[model samples]
Target: MTGLRIIFMGTPEFACPTLRTLIERGENVVAVVTQPDRPKGRGQQTLPPPVKVLAEQHGITVLQPVKVRLPESIEQIRALEPDLIVVVAFGQILPKALLDIPKHGCINVHASLLPRYRGAAPLNWCIINGETETGVTTMMMDVGLDTGDMLLKSATPIDPDEDTQSLHDRMSQLGAELLAQTLDRLVAGELTPEKQDDALTCYAPMMKKEDGLIDWTRSAQDINNQVRGMTPWPGAFSFLDDKLLKVYKVQTASGAGNPGEVVAAGRDGIEVACGEGSLLIRELQLEGKKRMSAGDFLAGYKVPAGALLGKKDGAVGA
Candidate 1:
């Protein structure tokens, strides 16, 4: 433990927590590697990765390699001579050459229970698929995508009303805690990596902006799942007069009518008909407008009774 020199690789806020946790516990993080600063936000300002900022604040050496697989970047990390490399949401795949450089090998703190949710956006997919339980896993690095030997894991129950934003915060902290404990065992040589069962593997594909489109032909439950899954990012939306109408909050309704019809509207909310049931839209935001309650949207807009509430049938890009 006394001579353990660590190199930490991470990018986002999710990774910041783990880096801070390691530093607070007095670990020797010899270097920090994160993605390079990139244009972000509406103004397109160049912003540093969250992990990079934290590392600089603590006086840790920061490396932002644009192409991690390049020979130069691999050589830089190899020269560090780290005892272990800790990665959390590092935003890049590691090559075997870099993985072999560390004395104890690399460890990844993944937000999902592997072999399930193996891709980039695991937490969002878990909520989208309506999973009641999900957890964190620390695994030994491998060349395959999140296909690594499990070192440690712990589960937490998902609440019925939990959305991606809430669940992500919880999982982020949980991953930090689990990762710290895993490093403790590694220092003591008390941990053993276990191979994952490929037969039970599931994948969580990265989300696209077009994936947020709401189809009235899906069940209210599925629609609700999408709304929760996409919240705070790539929001679930429908079309109204060929404009995108982002749906922020909604609940399943008991009543049913023709799909895509606004069956009722009042202070309670706007109940829109779905394929199998209905959705009580509690919160929404129309394009070029501020987010407002469904009741407020109805108050300002002229939505005639029995009028269809989505893009015209067969209209492209609706």
Candidate 2:
């Protein structure tokens, strides 16, 4: 419990809080295993993973293996003498060789309740699916993808207006807190593993840019969910007169018009009709233009009353 040689495996910013919590609690984090640095941003400069940066700050040893299943990678992890490996958004399916090296095996801190939204993009899909509540699950890892037995779970409600960015930040801290509880229970020998019901499984595949395309035929609430889910990346968009109109925020309204028709365009908001109901678009970005309020956009760009969306596949943002 006190001197457990732990190896922390994770990548993105979502993974940082758990690692930070482990260190803050004085857990024996001997090494950090994160994905390799790669080109990012418009400059395409190679940058380290958020986990690596955090680990280095605390002077913990860091490891970046292209493929965790490779011989060298396996050997490196094996030599760490890890009693347990705590993985969070590690971005790789660890092989059994590495998983078996640790005395207590690997434990994953996932972002969703097991058997539901289990896959690469659970955070994004949970919102897109309009789930009412979701939470963190710490599970004993196996060869399968998020198919491992669950050790602990903590649930929280999803806010109606919550975007992925805001929800992600909230859940990152939530996962950290839940993981601390899990580790303590594990150390106390009070943890019980629960098998997930396959009958309740739902896969949340990785998001695509095309997935953000707003289908006017869908209800306003559904489109609103899509907008929330894709926020800050692969953002929800509609074609505005052959141009990409990125929709950042929207509120459901009660007006009536043909789907995609502009109910009204003004300083307050751009009211657009949906299949079932209308939407008050509060914020958006035109192609090759900066994101702005609907009022500001309307002040400059031309969005007439009868203008249609989804007319064609508009150009992608520069």
Candidate 3:
């Protein structure tokens, strides 16, 4: 357990906690391998990845290779003679050469309970699909994508009011703690790696901006999930008076009207009918405007009853 020469590979905020935990627990982290700094934000200024920033703070050597599978990249890592390569959200895939370089091979801390949810945006998809439970999984990496053998898993319930941002923060902490336990069990030879069943696997591809387009034909509950899952990113949106309207918070309501029709628009909330049930819009943002409560929006804008929302392209029935 002690003196385990670990080479950490990761990027983004999610990976920071794991790398920090490993260092805090007295692990001998020799070097940090992360994605290269790239231009970010409105100014297009280049910025270091979160992992690289954390590594630099602790004086750990940081490696940022454009192509991690290259011969030079492989050699650079091999020179470190790492006992274990701990990977978490490290954009690039590791070649077989790098995987074999580490004494104990490589291990990944993923944000899902494999093989159920596997891929780039598991946490987002879980909430979008209305899943009641999800968790983190630590696996021994292999050639296949997230098809690695599972070492340990820790489950947690998905709160009804939880948004993608909140769930992501929670899962990151959980993954860090779970990873610490996994490393300890691995060093003690008490860990049992189980092969992931491809039959139960589900792919969660990277989210697209268009994925937030609200379809009133869908059930109210489904649309509510979309609002929760897409928050703070490609936010859930619908067309209102031919302008983009982003939905921040909503709840199921009882009403009967054509899908997308505004059953009632008042200070209480905007009750919009769906293919099944209805939705009470509690919070939203109009095009080129700041987010506001339904009551404030109603007072300023006149969204009278029976107005068809999503009528931009005549998608909703008249």
Top TM-score prediction, candidate number: 2
Worst 10 residues of 2 by lDDT: 309-318
Candidate models: Cα lDDT each: 0.88, 0.90, 0.91
Better of 1 and 3 by TM-score: 1
lDDT string for model 1 (51-88, tens) is: 99999999999999998999999999999899899999
**Ranking according to TM-score, highest score first:** 2, 1, 3
Residue range 74-177, candidate 3, lDDT tens digits? 99999999999999999988888888998898999999999988889998899999999999999999888899999999999999989999999999999999
C-alpha-based local distance difference test score of model 3:
0.91
Give per-residue CA lDDT, model 2, range 1-318, as digits (tens). Answer: 356899999999999999999999999999999999999999999999999999999999999999989999999988989999999999999898888999988999999999898899998999999999999999999999899999989899999999999999999999999989988888888999999998999999989998998888788898899999999878998888788789999999998888888889999889888888988999999889999999998888888898777747432222
* Candidate 2 residue runs with Cα over 4 Å from true position: 313-318
Off by over 4 Å in 3: none
Judging by lDDT against the true structure, name the best candidate. 3
Number of clashing residue pairs in every model? Answer: 0, 0, 0
